[model samples]
Target chain A: MKFLCGIALIALPAFTFYCWLLLDSETFLSLLQESIPIQTQYIGLSNRLLALVPGLIPIALLMRGAWHLRRLFGLFAVRAFFHEEIAQRLHGFAFMLVFSVLAKPVAGALSSAALTMNYPEGERSISVTIESGDLTTLFIGVIFLIIAWVLREAHQLSKENAEIV
Target chain B: MSILVNLDAMLAKRKKRSRELAEYVGITEQNISLLRTGRVRGIRFSTLDKICEFLECQPGDLLEYKSNVDLTQ
Candidate 1:
């Protein structure tokens, strides 16, 4: 449901920039005077924001809802890879590991992009290179992968031992 | 992923020579029946070695390997 995030992905930065321009510097006039989206320059852009409002709330809620069920998803994944008994106990690790494998890096990229947009250019261009966020997310993903790998390996070994006994 | 046992053949070969081998194997005939039917999870190398010795057959004769293909379908 990455599309659930599409509107927020598009609008959050614009909304953030609009806010920063509105309230941050006392010099809203000069910033507004710069080449900008014509709609934003004219008004509060209320209708555009209103269009986003309905979509944003539900998507945010859905995203969190998906997060809440990650454990369930993990159990399902472990069950796919192993058996019911081992999978039930491995639910948390499986969820985190699989989630990390599948989505967290993309998530980090999106978040880092949002984070990048939040900051000012300052006297220098803000180094909001996609790589900046990608690196951290990649690190996290690898850790999760390793965790899943180690636990799964241990489980397989135990299952093998069970046969021996 | 690797060597898989055909305990059915090995057991059939062994139950003839010594009932003691069957008794000491920590498995009832019923459990052996389940194993023979390929319904077991795994086996120890020690058990495999013992079965091999009793049957006077190599482990390879008891087990075979092939590339694991998706068989769910």
Candidate 2:
């Protein structure tokens, strides 16, 4: 449990930094051009920075998820298995993941629009993309949410059992 | 609340302390205290068996059902 907490502590910042770096990289622009129906050549530095604005939505959600995961691990490390906070943190992380997945298409559309904002007025486009990865994330998030609910039920049972002689 | 615990009376009749019964029953003194005061939700069958065996009494001697008792209280 301590090891997992340590890993989560490291992963939180690592993932956040990785996402920021990825969003700012040239590779991301090329990938965006391939996935989004937009002219990557017309995307200047200002447009690229503008495009990063939409990416922040998922990044923020993921960061919050990571924070909740770290806290949950911290509770486990202290042997607080049946604590209400454990279920709450798991629920928070799960919902953050679910919201991040849901925000993907909206962010993608906004990013595409931001990227094409500098283009000729008639040439600008707004495109929404949904990949298989988003569906997978949503599925996992729902599973975690169910687990959190079960954990809460288990906590209640534990409390009741503790009151018994 | 209708199911009343008479553990205190049984323990007194048996001339045994709560600490001694707690040790023999493999439970905490705090739990014994709760049982004696009728503050517990319920007693496990194994624990009840241990207590009855230690006190040489039946389950009925340690518990009673009172229909007129105010459950909420």
- Compute the interface RMSD for each candidate structure: 2.9, 0.5
Q: List the residue pairs that clash in candidate 1.
A: A163-B42, A164-B44
The number of residue pairs in model 1 that clash at the backbone is 2
Point to the candidate with the largest lDDT: 2
Please state the CAPRI-style docking class of candidate 1: acceptable
The segments of candidate 2 whose C-alpha lies over 4 angstroms from its true place after superposition are A1-28, A34-37, B67-73
Candidate 2 lDDT, tens digit per residue, A33-82? 54466655535667666777786788778878888888888888788887
The Cα error of candidate 2 at residue B17, in Å, is 0.2
lDDT of 1 by residue, A21-122 (tens): 444333443442231211122333343243233324423433443443444454455565454333333333334434433343343334333333423464
lDDT of 1: 0.48
What fraction of the true Cα-Cα contacts (under 8 Å, chains A to B) does candidate 2 also have? 1.00
Model 1 segments more than 4 A misplaced: A1-138, A153-165, B1-23, B28-31, B38-45, B48-73
Distance from true location, Cα of A1 in model 1, Å: 23
Residues B6-69, candidate 1: write the lDDT tens digits.
7766666656533555576655666566556656776667777776777788878877775556
